[model samples]
Target chain A: MLAFIIRRLLQSMIVMFFVAMVAFLMFNYVGDPVHQMVGIDTSFKDREVLRESLGLNDPVPLQFVRFITNAAKFEFGISYQHKRSVTGLFKERLPATLELSFVAAFLSLVVGVPMGVYAGIKPDGWLSKIFMTFSLVGVSLPTFLIGILLIYIFAVTLGWLPSYGRGDVVNWGWWSTGITTWSGLKALIMPAITLGLFQLTLIMRLVRSEMLEVLRTDYIKFARARGLSDRAIYFGHALKNTLVPVITITGLQIGSIIAFAIITETVFQWPGMGLLFLQAIHNVDIPIMAAYLMLVAFFFVVINLIVDILYYVVDPRLRLDLGKANGA
Target chain B: MNKPLLSVENLRIEFPTRRGTLVAVDDISFTIDPGEILGVVGESGAGKSLTGQSIIGLLEPPGRIASGSIKLNDRRLDNLPYAQMKKIRGKEIGMIFQDPLTSLNPLYTIGRQLTETIQTHTDMTGKQAKKHAISLLEEVGIPAAAKRIDHYPYQFSGGMRQRVVIALALCVNPKLIIADEPTTALDVSIQAQIITLLKKLCADHGTAVILITHDMGVIAETADRVAVMYAGRLVEIGKVRQVVKEATHPYTKGLMSAIPSLTHRMEELTQIDGTMPRLSDIPKGCSFHPRCPECMDVCKEKQPELIDIGPTQVACWSYHDRQI
Candidate 1:
């Protein structure tokens, strides 16, 4: 298990390195960093000094090497707009995004899995059909649209739920956030639902189809023949078998949830890394943008690593041989 | 014989299709007394497996028991509620599917499966159930039964998995077992061992068995009585020895002739022409008439009902009145 984890971590690093490289190059193409660093009023000599200090005078490749080396130490330089370390900006907003994602993941799993299992068990039942149709809608509708629709309903039409912002007088700390407050939790519901609905569809559809396929398997039939009750058959035998794939898909779906949470956070005016990213984009904060991109990449690899570990935990067959996971 | 362990009568299984209902297993009837082994032999698509599946209420949808009744211990099982039938399944009638690899869930240990079945059907405590599970594993010939009980299905060889499956079926001490080609997935040598082990287990427990397979050799060695199926119908059923020697049904004779014989040194094996018709295209009256070498004009027009012919019962026009 240790060997497998080490191998995966090494692979993740290689992938993250390429992502970091791409993110570093993106700023060089979009606009000159020199323009943001030194205004027109600054003398040409002073501008050249600034450019040289920022390593803009050096070759693009040399600058990239320097940026990569610094990024390796979690130092993506200082954000030009905020005048704070890129890493500090990320650390502050990372918790909010994590908090939002946790709620969204919670909502998605709580509502989606049971519904998926229901649809799979009763493919023709009215409730399953309704859930399936909604699942399709969840998949088809964009996150922004869902966010807007939700705000229109709860905040505008009904005037029941809060529409935007994390919370009043929010404490935006690295560990503690608006999420820690009651009003913040209430504000979280709308965006979490909006962000999670799309993922809910993915998880639901995955679980439903997998459940249907598993329901038809010989083992399930044997389980039934062995006189296991409907509860035991459906939940214990069938559900247990369906979990490995569900966990893998759900892990991959986490990337999208975080991806969608950016839009969701922006729509609700919630304070998170995604909102920070958008603001960074407007200000042409290359350090923050590059860090954001690398962070997202890092998330994908880490979550996938967790997924692989979970697959081992859930499926004994995968744990048998160290490198034969694919062959198996 | 007073109340046979299992009695299936005029059992017709069908699958709904867009065109119409397709009959998978036509009107077939048989009974098994306690401790008796009844081998059901047929070619592919002959409904042998379907018959076994129907008895255990494990028939895949949209295939269902369309007509007739299945009685276990004098209780009607054909039309029981799904919940009631579930209770009867592992307790009254156990089933072993054809593929052992697929029959056992890969995620669970063989011991867990056995104990789960035991606990579900009986009130045995976890400790007692675990002990019973190990005993069952040991009984099925798994080496290091106590230690190996914790191992998953993938750890065992194909033959060992099938043995584990057999042990699982026997865990609840079911009155009857429907073994659907239990040894078909094993090596030829291992097939004999499994068959012997199964026969001994069933005899020791006095559990009736319906061994469904296409292997006539398995039937000759294991089955007390043999039932020959063609298309969806049981064309012949009789004492194993009598059916082997004097198969009155033409299809049964065809099956017997196809078996290789070391004593005769035949230049070539006999071939029964024409394939078993698909469910959608089964011929009117007798399904085997197209393939039977002794096809008669009436055989194609009218389906023959199973009738007694010496020690065997055959469903063929040739034996209607000893006309042959």
Candidate 2:
């Protein structure tokens, strides 16, 4: 198991290196930091000094090595748009994005799994039909449109919520969460739903199909023949089998959730990393963009590694194969 | 007989399709006494498995017992509520399914599976159940029962898995066990070992068995009484020695002749002329008439009812003296 984890860590390092290289390449093409940093009245000699100090005058390979080394230490220079250190900006905004994504993911799972199981157990029931219809709507409608619809309903029509922005936040050291405050939570509701809707439906459909497939397996039939109670058979035997695939899809979907929260963030004007990334893109803030890319890549690698380990944990067949491989 | 352990009377199973209701198990009747092994032999699609499933009340949907009474120790089982049936299952009747490799859940340890079944049907504590499960594994001949019980199903070979399946069925010591083609998925050499283990365990537990298989060889060795089914009906039933040596029904005789013999080497193995008829297209009269070599004029016009013929019960026109 330790060997397996070490091997996966090595693979993650390789992936992160490639992403770092891509982020380094983005720095060269996306406009010079010197122009963005200085005013028109600044002398050319001052600009040259600033460029040299920033290591823009260094060899390309040396600069890339520096970028990689600095990235490893979580240093990403300064955001040109905000005139603040890129890491500091990320540190401030990451909690909001992660908070929103996690809540959305959690809501989807807590609600979606049971709904999926119900639909699967009784595929033709009236409630299942209603869930299927709702899932269809959740899957088909775009995130931005959903966000606007929610805003129009709860914020405009009902006057129940704030239309845009993180309403208020309570700081717990470096981490600031809007959930601790009522107005903040109410403000979080619409954007989180909009961001989580696609994933909710995806999880629902995947879980439902997987549940249906698992229920038909010979083991399930045997479980029934063993005269196991319906509850034990469905939840204990069948649900555990379905979880392997659901975990895989849900892991990938979570990575996408964090990476793709840009539109939803923009729709609600939520003060999160996605909004930061969007503004960075418009202003051509290369440091912030590069940092965002590396962070997202890191998330993907970590999630995939976690999913692989979960497969080993959930399935004994895989564990035996892995043990053999290690022993050999 | 001292109160038959299980009895089925005129059981008719039907599948309602878009075309029409197709009879799968057509008016089959049999009884199994306590501690007796009854072998049910038939060709594929002969409804042998359906009969077993119906007895266990685990028949798949769209196919249900249309008219019948299944009684266990004189308690009516056919129309019992699902909750009542569940209580009887595993506690009163156990089932061993074909394909042992797939029968056990791969995600669970054999110990957990066994203990869960034990706890479900009994009032045993978790620790006691585990101890019982380990003992069961050892009884079925699994090596290092304590250690092996924690191992998942995939760790065991085909023969060993079948042993585990047998152990599971015998865990509760139910009065009757319905083993549906239990050794069909095993290797040829492993098949004999499984059959032996099943026989020994069932005997040890005093668990009567309905051994469903197509192999006459298995029936001859393992069963006390043998039932021969052709299509959806019981064509013949008698003592194993009598059925193997002196089959009276033409279909049963054909089935006996089809089994290759080592004592008298034959130039070629005998085979029945035609396949069992499809459920939707079963013949109006004797379902086996089309394939019987001794097919008579009356055989094609009316179905023959089972009648006592000295040592055996034969369902054939030849056994009956009636003209019509």
Candidate 3:
């Protein structure tokens, strides 16, 4: 198991390296940081001096090595728009984005799994039909539209929530959270739902179909014959079998949730890394853009690694195979 | 005879489809006394397995008992509510499926599976159940029962896994076991070993068994009484010796002859002329008449009911006339 984890860590390093390279490439190609920083009337010689100091004229290979090394320390220079250290800017915003994405992912799993299990156990029941219809709506409607619809309902019509922005944040050292306060939590509700809707539906459908298929397997028939209670058979035996695939999808979906938080963040104007990334794109803030790229890719790699470990834990067949391969 | 452990009277199972209701097990009746091993033999689609499923009240959806009474120790089982039936299952009646490879849950340790079943039907605590599970595994011939108990189903070979399944069925010491083609998925050599183990275990537990299979050899060796079903109907049922050596029903005779013999070498093994009729297209009269070599006009015109002929019960016009 130690060797397996070590191997996975190695693979993650390779993936992060490629993402770093992409971030580095964007620095060279995507607009000039010096041009964005300098005043419109600045002298040419002064601009050259400023560029030189920023190492813009450095050799490509040396600059790439510097980019990789500096990125390792989370140093991405300054955001052009904010003129603040890019890492510091992201550090302030990281907690909000992380909190939002996690809550959304958690909500998706907590709500989706039971719904899926119910729909699966009784595919033709009226309640299943209602769940199927709701899932269809969740899957078909775009995230932005859903966010707006929620805003219009809860914020505008009902006057129940704030339409935009993180309501209020409490800071604890480096981490900031909106959940500890009432208005802040109410503000979080719509965006989190909008961000998590598609994923919840996807998880529900995947789980439902998987549950249906698993229920038909011979083991389930045998389980029934064994006179196991309906509860034990469905949740204990059947649910555990469905989880291997669910874990794979949910892991990837969580990665996408963090990456795709941009849309929800923009819809609610929740100040997070996504809003920072979007503003970076508009002003060609290469450092912030590159940092965001690396961050998202890092999330993907970490999630995939966690998923691989979960597969080993949930499935004994895989564990035995790994043991055989390691001769342990 | 002492009170029968299980009795099925006029049991008819049907599957409602888009076309019409197709009869799967048509008016089959049989009884198993305590400690008796009753072999139910038939070709594919012959409804042998369905009969076993009906007895356990685990028939797949859309297929249900159309008309019947299944009694266990004279308690009506056919119409019991699911919760009530569940109490009887695994406690009063255990079941073994066809493919042992898939019968045990792949995700669970054999010990967990065994102990879970043990606890479900009994008052044993976790530790007691685990101890009982290990002993049951050892009884089924799994080596190093204590250590192997924690191993998952995939760790065991096909034969060994089937033994685990047998152990599971026998864990609670249910009075009756319905083994549906239990040896069908096993290797040729492994089949005999499993059959012997099953017979011996059932004997040891005094568990009446409904051994459903198509192998006549298995029936001859393991069963006390043999039931021959052809296309959803019991064609003949009698003592194993009488059924194997002196089958009176034409269909049973054909089935007996189809088994290859080592004592008398022949150029070819005899086979019945036609396949069992599809449920939807069963002929008006006797279902097996189309395939019987001694097919008579009367056989094609009217279905023959089970008629006693000395020690054996045969379903044929020949026996019907003799009885009259």
TM-score-best of 2 and 3: 3
* Candidate 2 per-residue lDDT over residues B70-136, each given as its tens digit: 9999999989999989988888888998999999999999999999999999999999999999989
Best by DockQ: 3
Backbone clashes in model 2, listed as residue pairs: none
Best model per TM-score:
3
**Tens-digit lDDT track of model 3 for A1-328:** 9998998899899999998998899878887878899899999999999989989899988899999999889898888889889889988999999999999999999999999999999999999999999999999999999999999999899999999988888999999999999988998988899999999999999999999999999999888888899999999999999999999999999999999999999999989989988988888889888999999999999899899999998999999888888899
lDDT by residue (tens digit), candidate 1, B32-80: 9888999999888889988888887777789999999989878898888
Misplaced by over 4 Å in model 2 are B322-324
Q: Mark the 10 consecutive residues where model 1 chain A has the least summed lDDT.
A: A168-177
Please estimate how well model 2 matches the true structure, expressed as its whole-model Cα lDDT: 0.92
Q: Model 1, stretches more than 4 Å misplaced?
A: A26-30, A52-69, A169-173, A323-328, B322-324
Lowest summed lDDT over 10 consecutive residues: which window, candidate 1 chain B?
B315-324
| Residue-by-residue lDDT tens digits, candidate 2, A1-328 | 8899999999999999999999999989878889988899999999999999999999999999999999999999988889999999998999999999999999899889999999999999999999999999999999999999999999999999999988889999999999989989998988888999899998899889999999988889888878899999989998899999899999999999999999999999988999999998898999999999999999999999999999999998998888898994
Candidate 1 lDDT: 0.87
Alpha-carbon interface RMSD for all candidates, in angstroms: 0.8, 0.8, 0.7
Q: Which portions of model 3 show Cα errors greater than 4 Å?
A: none
